[model samples]
Target chain A: MNEQRRDVLDLLAEGKITATEADQLITALERDQPPVASSSDTRPRGRAKYLRVMVDTLDDGESGQINVRVPLQLLRAGVRLAAVLPPQVLERANAGLSKSGLPIDLTQLKPDELEALVEHLDELVVDVDQPDAKVRVFCE
Target chain B: MPQLVTVRVTRVNRRPVRIWVPVLPVVLVLAPVLVLAVLAAAAACRVYRISVARALGSGWRVISALPGTQLDIGLGRSAVLVTIR
Candidate 1:
């Protein structure tokens, strides 16, 4: 019924596009439409406050567990601290991080970038399950 | 609004130990010393050509954001937990 759908149909009727191509274009348009919210789901959404990491491992019949919750504000402060750090210190920290397989550059961190990173982190969830170990990282 | 931190430690064959640390009282007690330290840090930052105000702001932010953090670790029969609230 939309203009795009009508145009696709017109192309099909004029033999410019095959029926299969018209159908594909309509399906693609449908896929691109925004999702409609359901009336039954109306929970209020709040900004995430903490980043949590949990690990549980079993080795040689012994079990160990670790849980850590880090405030997102702390992470923001840390980035601010990086801004005040000496250039040499940032360089050394970056070198050490790179040596440890993390190639992050602290000198390039900005408040805006940190905000974007936190926003993305709010939707991130990682889970790793093994026969004897489990690891989870998420935000809440 | 967090004003305290509770730490609990338990060991095998030993009773668990719990301690509650009041943050406000500690901060009040150390206020004078903290002021002097900050002044000295500011002087040092001037010598190093760093921004004293920004450094102090970041430090305060880090301290203020410490509340609501939690850590828990357990191994075998020993466990430790720390919560800020």
Candidate 2:
């Protein structure tokens, strides 16, 4: 078994998480990790190396926050992909229009206005959409 | 002991090349021109190829912070900074 898979199983056995939770964690880990490449045709081998993206959520009062440390390569990829997406993706990903008059509100701007802003911030965004309600990715 | 593998390398000059060619029919001429345009554009990009072998060479270390939280990661002379909003 891979290191990530083994780590997940260890977590499950410790009763820190349920079996289903372990499966979900494994799936997410696999998506970011490629398979191991062995020199021989068949052998028990070590897990492949990869940039590990660790995501953690915290609740403070009524607000939720997340912090992530990603590899530079992954960061570059996200920045490139974010540059090409339509404004609707950002708007929809934010869940709804922000009532706060923060300069980041997209719904307040016209299509042309948003396009102009995107041209300037092409290097600062990433697009990682959440797959379920339990988790919402705030950053690319 | 570390084992080394040998591989052949091919180098291509970046300067535009001059070629003498026969004039083709109009239909053939347009297709070759479009093909050449695409090839030139593709060659112009500075391609950075990160092979899978290289990527899987080392295990990456990660550090993360939760919402309403902050963290700092470093090595050797290490440091940690946390500010909550």
Q: List the candidates' TM-scores in order.
A: 0.79, 0.18
Which tens-of-lDDT digit does each residue in A8-64 have in candidate 2?
Answer: 999999999999999999999989886767755353433222222233233332222
DockQ comparisons of all candidates to the true complex: 0.84, 0.03
Give the Å shift of residue B13 in candidate 2: 65
Whole-model Cα lDDT of every candidate shown, in order:
0.88, 0.42
lDDT of 1 by residue, A1-140 (tens): 78988999999999999989999999999898878677435435677899999999998898999999999988877777777888888899999999999999987877688767876786789999999999999999
Candidate 2 iRMSD, 1 decimal: 12.8
- Which pairs, if any, clash in model 2? A58-B67, A65-B67, A65-B68, A66-B67, A126-A140
Residue B42 lDDT in candidate 1: 98
Query: What lDDT is reached at residue A1 by model 2?
Result: 78
* Model 2 agreement with the true structure over B2-85: per-residue lDDT tens digits: 012122222243332332222234336599786786455444322323232322221111111111223332222222333322
DockQ of 2: 0.03
Error of 2 at A97 (Å): 6.3
